[model samples]
Target chain A: MTSQGVWTPEVVADLLLTAESSRTPVGSVTGRWPDFDLAAAYRTQDVGMKRRTARGERVVGVKLGLTSPAKQRQMQVDTPSVAWLTDAMELPPATVVPRSRLIHPRAEPEIVFVLGEELAGPGVTAARAMHAVSAVLGGIEIIDSRYSGFRFTLPDVIADNNSSSRYVTGSVQVNPDGFDLALEGCLLEVDGQVVDSATGAAVLGNPAHALAFAANQLAERGHALQPGWVVLTGGLTEAVPLAPGSHIAAHFSHLGSVVIKAD
Target chain B: MPTGLAGQHDSRTAVLNAEAAERLLAAYAGGEPAEPVIERHPAADVSDAYAIQRAQVVRWIAAGDQVAGYKVGLTSRAMQLQSNVDQPDYGHLMRSMFAPEHVPIPATMFIQPRVEPEVAFVLSRPLRGPGVTIADAVCAIDCLLPALEIIDSRIRDWRITIVDTIADNASSGAVVLGGRPVSPRAIDLRLAGCVLYRNGEIAATGVGGAVLGSPLNSLTWLANTLGPLGVTLEAGHVVLTGSMTRATPVAPGDRVSASFAGLGSVSVQFAPEQQEAAR
Candidate 1:
């Protein structure tokens, strides 16, 4: 009787969780773990999220990684990967994030949606998907790689939940009807200097399409986006580094601004 | 534990619209606020909120109420964070909503009322717009008057989301307009400044540019936003050009006033609890 499996989803999830909890970085899983594939990667993500939920962390929303073509090319992936966000990952407004708890963190500005209704799909269009959105807010995502040098393959990242660390949303939540979201602009600033800038179009042409894709992708897994859930579409511009006492801010064209400082 | 949930969005939307409108209407009639409607109407979006607002307008018109004007809300950055909404929204000002200048208003007329200083635009001619310009809006104006908007919430403790405030008529309660009316071109409206005082103490200071780069732009935005929907800024209609500073709280017997640099000054008082003002 064989009682051992080295590359099972549960085992991979356990190893990833252990490394994540200790704030330690590990190498890529490619060629190291046998039977490691994309489907198994997704299963590992699901199992990891389940363990988090079991520990009393509520799933607040979902986040998309590698949504942009440039990001996909850099990661050598054609499709984006999805990850779950828990309440424990939320950073309250005006609170400084302590960098000592993180191995290395980079910040990206995002277009976030707070859904007003359930969005389920497989054949959903961006126009139809927007009907479910209530408000849009500027968001900052802290993406930390649990893998060394932030180097990982597609399956490696999907299993690691795209290295999500924490997120903070702006105080302002505006109705999406107020502006053309595709042209929505954002400026990523560090220490009061503009470091990066990108429009909403950078995120998969339009963020709404990414949202539609998210809904369709969730449907594939027998899940759906529910009301009041916050969806982080994806990072719009290249991420910038975080250091102690750095004044970081993302100013959006119409969605107001979100500012954070690293302590 | 769940099954298919497709093709039912339309019917589900209507139910949410009706339920949202009903609660807000009840709160309006009883002069008492309700719990935040967003919690109960999970599917209410901005469009759904506007639909609820329009439904109430219909009912109010049927009840012999006359449309007075329009009031814009959440114009400044500070106001955005205060109310937790990013973009601006507007509400209708019924004929019954205007309070006389320098008169004491009854406290019971509103629930958790706060005051805002504004530059009121009383239109001279009807303005229709899909692409209305700033000049067109300035040309339509008869005059600008110093004004105070008594903003009240129909959501308990002002725990409002965007849907909640829009459904409650942009958190509007009463308008107090006064001061010597000045021609639109008599002064640089963008640079116009004002000092708001509450009970003989300076409360807030701001300039006209605080409202969407100028109250003129806000006027054009209103005309353009509503014109596509078939709403016009009619002649003699008073357009409250949004708040210039953060809204300050008001209580019974409290006196509040605002002095504008070139537009003169206006004031209002909240009468002590004795009897409700004539409605």
Candidate 2:
């Protein structure tokens, strides 16, 4: 209502930032602006990123969302999208998460890529995407959506940075050249029970493709994958909820296993 | 309830809450109940216990389970006194908590299970507010359903304080709702008498008046209590009113049933003991 009775990118970004900062769950952004499209959503996301940068948070990496064909169909979107990750979102080694500061969060396993060289492209192929990689690491993405019930449309989620909150990376880093990433397997366990399992192919059938997808998506948005920047491929399985006292672990075929205690 | 990060015996610390929740979830997974959580966090209040309960609810919902409703516990004055509590507590009822009727519940489902009969409230209209009254509960109540709540404790030997039981989801194990749905206004629930039969013989009998004077009052209490927490007794949500009788212990191969006058009946049969159940 501030500008022509429509939600400007600034207004939407401010609303979202407030929601995230206060850990308050609000309705989806699309609910307020019914006509917002994918392009405008990216603008709002950029606006939110700028706000973070102004607050002393630097962009650390890039991540993809809806890379799973199943998730794509569920979100009614044909392709995956990219979002920025800041240093403020990292959960360092042996650090306990501040549970009271976060709303309900869920953990999803991801394939992470560390870049050796900067790359920008609108037509980045999977092979070209792999050429920039220095090493690949295992990661657990902690997603806590600001939207109530995690219900959001494509544009709604994009503007919210795809519910990105916190993430932790594993130690074992392997070169991608000889890796059988398409067949890479992951087991998500909670309380010693194997709850869900998936292969790297679950994310666009080889996470390299997802990396390439992120590059092209970023090119259109005037950004590039930079050297030393990590790229998190989308979730391989449905994210499991994180609660105080829950013990969750992810076992990867090539990358080392990671365990996190919700505290 | 947070005593900061310092080791203080005056209150329940946040770390201890998480650790306590881990203990409960571990016992749930291992099928071996642990000692009472209150003993470890002696200063943990009802609010801290609620915080622990909510943490588990977050875990269950993430595991692809949906919360079907809420349950009111310790509504009877006598039962409240026995538990040394002046007020009742509520817990989240998950969809997975509904055990199938007529089928034998596995011996491994709970650690030392007990049975209690209740008159469940099915809301046709959502109930929310700081001022929800019995009349409001009456209007929103769609129907009364016969229900049998199988109570189980994650705390060993059921040595539970009010906080202990609250943190353990009011000792909720599973629920079985059966028989016909009675209209809210069609029956006077306070006078509804129930005869619970275990092994085909009378084991317990009680009237709905035992539940906070009337079952409707219990419904009112739940709605009013949950309002400040930003939760609503949603339409189509099932609310299990407080138990009408004392909880009776049940072991493997036990057949339990309760029939309410002018309402309906519900029952459950625990499966016979098996060697594999030891796991």
Candidate 3:
């Protein structure tokens, strides 16, 4: 340890900055933040970034990340991770993005819920998270990172907002009542080619459960996902990569389809 | 205010102000650069971070930008480990992020780009309530399909604090869905195999098990998680489970394909840079 026997913020920042600059994974950054434990380092970095966001004046949304079993298994954890959101990043349906500025871009069709009320911990359940949702709809998530070459560790990934980028939705916004997410199926098409099919069950059995898990997780952190907040359940299927001048469409067996194009 | 001709005003100062505002908005949208701002105010308190983010969101919405939806990240074990979190995080998506299918990618739009194979789901009924079960979730789905997600990021050197990512929408880039659908009950999703082919060669191969062992299980977890949060899974919505296999990167001129057992397959052709430039 340094003479103080405690990790210093400068050390943590410098290590993190090096990792980011080098486009190395979080595992590598760990080597630099010797005194700063991985999780503790994350918490410290989180606090610093949160302070920055607050100083700039932004609105906080629910924390995201931690919806994939593969991720959990890889991380050797049972629960998912999350990051706060501000109002500024919200986009409308069918928004177009330039391909050049993004570090690495990919897309996923997801079920999004907009909460009507705030829910907290103490018995946070999947069903309860569902009840808090005001509407559910089909959406496309465009995931991007600020890191060049898109290299980072799990810790780095979470710290980077789970690599969240942009999103678009379909016109049909419906009240999530009596929906059978698992049994439903979807067809993803690129141009006119028929490729890829799956069911809602692919997303951690049911997407509602993912949302519920996120809600309770947030509650444990003393941060409640308020009403009117938006929650994106895990992806129903694997993510699709993007290219310029491409047409991406998702047609659900019952939910209809949402389409977008790269310009 | 001093009554001065519009042209006579300090155009440079006004320009600087506008530029500063734009940066502020972007910082608000994403996270502020870890570097200290010129004014050098004391560091912000963590508790107040959300408030500031929310206010900026309101301003963006008021500016006529559409509220597309949201994105969940760090939900996967790999990501959680990489990010050093036990749970997932989330962010919002805007309309400006959408890209069409089969469109040639312009290399200039992204600092870097990569692709992943996935499955997308569409719901037929709403799945809500705190006690929603797997069976209940099963009954709510309409169809599922093979898909691809293009993940990109905006941070320089990919170095960003967590809050920086939170403001950036989880580094989401674009999405492409295949033209096929199937029922969840008809196949063994957990055992299903996914083969990712790049340029007619196997670059990566995995199974449904890779994605939490059956994408449905992921959804079930999501439902349970959201139940207490007052959220629900509605009909006519879509969900993207985590990757069924390891993420394999693709480049221009690379033709990619993913085949799933019983569910079907999807593919995309990366165009030549010159061809993309022509577009």
Candidate 4:
């Protein structure tokens, strides 16, 4: 236990990375720091990214969390938050899950946007957001909170990079043009049994709106989505707990399905 | 045939004279800048300059370039004082004029190119002039971006008056917009500041208020000025509202960057001229 006011961004990032590598959950840092604002959280995330890059992990793009109303309510937060994703987070399709690495991992289905051009925002609309997208694909994110009991505050989650651990993308890529994304549905199945299903509209009414929101959010921090960057729009349904030897798959209406074997 | 009596010419003769002036201006634009048109025709005013600009715009359109938006120049009191112009001027921006940041621009395409730091407004809604106010302008704006406008004079040695510049499309050349887009309501335009760097050294510094009191004021002026011409500042158009700092000349291999206080920074580099191809 350290002094409440002694946790700088570097110290906090170090503590989180230690917890992540050891696969051991730590107590929430929210109460330890006084007035830990969003800026401080983002700074901590930046430090964590530097630490990751130093370890030879390259940033692929970003992810949005707590975008859906249900997810926001579940997290007790009114607004959504962003997190960075590194290339190391990607898992090969149909590969067995690395259970030894993650702590109590959970899976959620997501829609991913592959950008064709750079997009900056403050006033990015859904219609204009589509023009920047090159393709849409189905994806599954494996979330593993570094905090004990998977319970944390907004700042805590942000500092943990939104509990991002691993991801697997679908093989099929569909062009976004003229595609009715709002009506695009996904079925989440576990061990060959349908557990949950949702539409693209489950993510902030539409997934494109999520992308626009991401652009506007990044603009607040003097950043923008670049060409070839993959953006993960938030999860569609409640994350299902992953157990060893279980098979998880998500089938999309337009985009093809993605399957992962947990071992 | 007397110079003073030329104003009393018949409507047919006036039309023919305008056509001839357009032809002369187009020829100059396609080739090299020669003597100022105002020096040859003392009767030419700002309106006549704009008419000539319209003819140049038609030529650009015919060349397969689309009109992106407009830019306001000579808006700052310092610029007006330096250029000896009492009022602001406007120019058209073609899609080709927009350059990506960090990209090296070819120097051979320009004549005596100079750069200035500016604040750009990206419109989200259409705004027309006459009754347009600052509030209307603000509401219509989607975001503000830091930008560097490359102004190149076609006129020889840039020795031209207000009429000459306006006729030469307000000496417009290229623009590089910053990656970050800030909401107009996020920061006070009057208080925003910028530091311009040339070749990695600070060349100039300025605040947003330097542009016609504020960039919002410049935008309002633009909306109102275009109203009577039946032109509206369309949605998604990027409007550059004059420069905060004086124009700085750049040589090949020189890199220029401007960092705005709230709206991030934008940079551009000039590449060495390519070897002339043999005929």
Candidates 1 onward: DockQ, in order: 0.01, 0.00, 0.02, 0.01
TM-score of each: 0.51, 0.50, 0.45, 0.49
Residue-wise C-alpha lDDT for candidate 4, range B117-199, written one tens digit per residue: 99999999999989999999999999999999999877778887887788788989899998899999887666455666789
Give candidate 2 misplaced runs (Cα > 4 Å): A1-263, B1-12, B275-279
Work out how many backbone clashes candidate 2 has: 0
Clashing pairs in 2: none
lDDT (Cα) of model 4: 0.82
User: Interface RMSD in Å per candidate, to 1 decimal?
Assistant: 16.0, 25.0, 10.5, 24.2
The clash count for each model shown is: 0, 0, 259, 0
Docking class of 2: incorrect
- Each candidate's fnat, listed in order, reads 0.00, 0.00, 0.00, 0.00
Fraction of real interface contacts that model 1 preserves = 0.00
Q: Which ten residues in a row have the lowest lDDT in candidate 3 chain B?
A: B33-42
Q: What TM value does model 2 have?
A: 0.50
Q: Which regions of candidate 4 deviate over 4 angstroms?
A: A1-263, B1-31, B274-279
